[model samples]
Target: MDIRLDDLTHPAIHALLEEHMAGMRALSPPECVFALDLDKLRHPSISFWSAWDGDTLTGCGALRELDAGHGEIKSMRTPNALRRRGAGKAILQHIIGVARARGYQRLSLETGAPAGFAAAHALYLGAGFVETGPFGDYQEDPFSRFYTLAL
Candidate 1:
């Protein structure tokens, strides 16, 4: 799969993001769902990327600047039809590499804390992220699990 920075203008991206939002809402309560929409992902502080296998969109992820030395992982999703093809891990590794390239000291993320999110948890931990308390503006919540990797 080829992964590249996306401008979020493609029709496939819009559809994928919409699917991501719907999946998040289905897994977590509305109040606990924090997936960013297209407009939000377009913010200057966030860098979004999409993975494509030829003409097919497989997955996407983003890195958001929390500060000069810190970044947060956001919106990691693999379409239902294209999962287990290594796109998610590739996107995640790309984010981590970019964070290091930007001189970030840490990278963190928030994900759900249920069986449904086991794959995500495994992906993160397998990439060397350790469970931690909330970072950034997040708060302690039973529905959420936080992880951080010290660079």
Candidate 2:
């Protein structure tokens, strides 16, 4: 799979992001939903990436600079058609490498606590992320599970 920085304008990226947001909305309550939309993903602090296999969009993920020594992982998604493939893992490893290269000492992320999020939880855990309390501007929400990795 090819993973590269995305400007968030490609039609395939747009569609994948829409599907990701929709999936988040369906899985989490309105108040607990924190998935970023296209506009938010384009924020100056964030770097978005899309994973592709030839012409097909396989997955996407993003890294957001939280501070000089810290960063946040965001918008990780692999469409149903490509689920269980290595795309998500590849995107995640790419993000982690980018974070380390950027001089970030730590990397964090927030994901759902629901049973439906088990796969993601396992994925993060396997990627060296440890469960932790809320970080950054996040408050204590039972619906959310946070993870952090020391780079």
Clashes of 2: 0
Model 1 agreement with the true structure over 59-149: per-residue lDDT tens digits: 9999999999999999999998888999999999999999999999999999998788999999999999999999989999988999999
Model 2 misplacement above 4 A: none
How far out, in Å, is residue 13 in model 2?
1.0
What is the C-alpha local distance difference test score of each model? 0.95, 0.94
| Number of clashes found in candidate 1 | 0
lDDT of 2 by residue, 1-151 (tens): 8999999989999888889888888888888988899999999999999999999999999999999999999999999788999999999999999999999999999999988899999999999999999998998888899999998
Instruction: Count the clashes in each prediction.
Output: 0, 0
Evaluated with TM-score, which candidate comes out highest? 1
TM-score for each candidate, following the candidate numbering: 0.98, 0.98
| Native-to-model Cα distance after best TM-score fit, residue 55 in candidate 1, in Å | 0.2
lDDT (Cα) of model 1: 0.95
User: Model 1, which residues run further than 4 Å from truth?
Assistant: none
